[model samples]
Target: MQLGTFSFVTKLAGFEYTKFVRYDDEGDLRVIKAENAGPHGFKTTNYSRVRSSSVAELTRSRLHGGELLMVFVGAGTGNVATVPEGKDFFLGPNIGMMRVETDTVSPRFVELFLRSSVGKALATAAMKAVAQPSLSMGTIRQIPVLLPPAEEQQEILRLVEQALTAAAECGADVREQQSSADILRQSILAAAFRGELA
Candidate 1:
C-alpha cells in the first residue's frame, strides 16, 4: 500500500500531537545525540550528561519501545535505526523519533522499510546539506511508506526478531572465540619466552 508522507499517516491514525516531546537535560538520563549512534544502532559507550535545567522537556517525537529513531536535523541526517527494548533514552536536537501508531502501522515494519534500499534512497533525497545535511519534520513527513496489512506486519516483525536474536547469539559466540584466541596467544608467547617451545 502506498502511503503519503509521515504526516499523512499520523493524521490518518488520529495522532493528536504533532509536536515532539522534549526531555530535560538532567539527572543520570543518558542523552543520545546523532554522534552517539553507530551504523547498527545506538552506541552507549560515551554519552552526555543531562542538566537538571533541561529535564521535563518533552518532544512529541519522544522515543519509546518499538519506535524507529531516525537521525534527522543533524550532520548524521538519514541515519535510521530502531530503538531496542528496555532502554530509557532521549534524543537530542540532531535526531527524530517516529512513533508508529500500532493500530494503523507496525513499528517493526517501519523499521525494516527504513533499513531498506528504497527507504535509504528516500532519506538521501529528503536530506539537505547547506552547512550540515539535515532533515526537517516536513521532509520526514513527505517520505512515502508501503503500508502492509496488519497481520503481515506482525509476521514480519516476528521473523525479524528471530533473525536478530540469532545474529546476536552468533556475535556473542564470535567474541567468545576471539577472547579464547587472545588467551591462547598470550599463553604461547609466555611459554616461548620461557624457552618451553625450544
Candidate 2:
C-alpha cells in the first residue's frame, strides 16, 4: 500500500495532557528535564538514565517500536530517528512520534526514507520559526511521502540494511587505523624523550 493511504494525526503525537505521579520520595522527577533526552535514531554507544522520582510523570510522549520519532520543536528540529527494538520510553515535549499504519505502509521502509536527504529537506521546510524553530503537526502531516508497493518496500529495506552493515564495518576499520597511528606517534614521542633514537 502507499503512504497516502494511511491516516495522519491532526496534532503532534504526545501533545495531549496527561497525569503524572511521583515515583520516589525525593523530588527526582522534577529534575528530569528535556536535556537528558537524546537525539532519536542516531545509535550512540552511551546513554545516561533520566532521573525521575515519579514513574507516571507525563512530561513527554510515549513511544513504541516501529514508530518514527521526529524532533519537531527543539534545537534538534528536523532530526529523525526510528524506535529500535522494544517500547517503554518517553519522548520529550520537543519530539513528535509518527506512528504509521502497518497495514498500509511498511515501517522499515518509511524509516529509511525519512533518513534520506529528501526526507530531511521536507522536515527542514516544515520547521516554524519561534523561540526555537519547531514543526507543527499540520506541517509535518502535509509533508509529501512517496510510497511503493509492499514487496518493493521489503526489497528496499533489505538493500538498506546491507549497505548500513558495510558502512559500519568501514567505519570500524577507519577507527582502528586511527588508533594505530596514535600509538605509533606516542611511541616516537617516548623514544625521543628517552634518547633511545639518536
Candidate 3:
C-alpha cells in the first residue's frame, strides 16, 4: 500500500471559526477546540457549540468518528485526539483533521502511534521553524507513519490497550493510598490540636 499522504488519509484540512457563525449554549453540535483534545480523549465540558441549523454550511467539517484531530498550531501543537464514534462534534479552529482513507490501516492504530513518543518526535520535527512553529497541511502530509502488517498493527494496539489499562489501575491504587494518607494525617492533626497526642 502507498504510504504517502493520500494513501492513508483522504482529507487533511483545518476548520476556521468565522464571524458569521454564532455560538449557542443550547446547540446540539459541539465544536472541539484544542483544549478539548485531552490525554485520554476529547473533553466535552464547556465546549462551544453552534446550532445545527446554523452550521449546515459547515457539515463538511463535522467529525464522523475515528477522525484524528491534530492541534496544528499554538502551545499544544502536535497534540492528537480521535473523535469518538457517534459524537456530534465539529472541528473547531486551530485543529486539523485527518480522515483515514483506507480500510487496510486502522485509524486507532494511527492515532495511538501519533500519540506515541516516537510519533510525537516526528511531528515535532515537522513543525515550522518560524516564530509560531505551526504545522502546515503540507508538512503534516509529509509526516511519515510506520505501517506494519495489518495483523501486527492490531497486535500492537492490543498490547498498548493492556498497558494503558494496567497503568490506569495502578494510578487508581496510588490515588486511594494518597487519600488514606491524607485522612490519617488529618486525624493526627486533629488529635494534636485537642492535646490528645500524649
Candidate 4:
C-alpha cells in the first residue's frame, strides 16, 4: 500500500532548527536537534530546551509519543526515530515528522520499515540540495511504502526489537570488560613500580 492514501498527518516543523538554546535541565519542552535524532532512540539527556516564551509553540509542534521523526537535511538526512511515551518534544527544523494514524497503520511498524535498507534508499533518492541535503513534504510523501499483512508486520517488529535489545546489552558488556581491563593494567603497573610484582 502507498503512504499518501491514508489519513496520515505528516509535517515539517517551523524553519528554526534546534538553535539558540541556553539549556535548562528543568525546562518545559525538549527541543529535538538534528544531531540527537538517531536510528535507535534519542539521546534525551543531551537535548536542548524550549524557552518559556516559546513554549506555546509546543502545543502545535509537540510530538504525541508515536510519530516517526525523520532528519530531512544535513548529514542526518534519512535517519528516523520515535520518541518514547510520556516525553514530548517540539520538532526542530530540517526535521520532518510523520504522525502515525494508527487506525490504518502501526507507528513502530512504519518507523522500522522506513529505517530499513530499502526504505533508506528511497529517501536518499528523493532527497534534494547539495550544500545541505533536504527533503520537502512532497518528496517524503512520494517515497514508496510496502505494507505486509498485519500479523507479519507485528512479528517483524517484535523480532527486531528483541535483537536490538540483545545487541545493546552486548555492547554494554564489551565496554564494561574494556574498562575492567584498563583498570587491571593500571593496578599491575602500580604494583611493578613498587616492586610488589617482581
Which candidate leads in lDDT?
Answer: 3
lDDT of 3 by residue, 97-121 (tens): 8877777788888778878898888
Instruction: Report the error of model 2 at residue 171, Å.
Output: 0.3
Sequence-dependent TM-score of model 1 = 0.70
Q: With candidate 3 superimposed using the best TM-score fit, by how many Å does residue 72's alpha carbon deviate from the native?
A: 0.6
Backbone clash pairs for candidate 4 read none
The lDDT values for all models are 0.62, 0.58, 0.76, 0.71
TM-score, per-candidate, Cα-based: 0.70, 0.74, 0.89, 0.80
**What lDDT tens digits, residue by residue, belong to model 1 across residues 67-170?**
66677655567676666677655555566666664476776677677667887687668577588777666677677777778888788889888998999999
> Alpha-carbon error at 97 in model 3, in Å?
0.7
RMSD of each: 5.8, 4.8, 2.6, 3.6
Name the candidate that leads on TM-score.
3
The residue-by-residue lDDT of candidate 4 on 78-106, one tens digit each, is 88777767877766666777775557477
Error of 2 at 100 (Å): 1.1
The Cα error of candidate 4 at residue 164, in Å, is: 1.4
Which is superior by lDDT, 1 or 3? 3
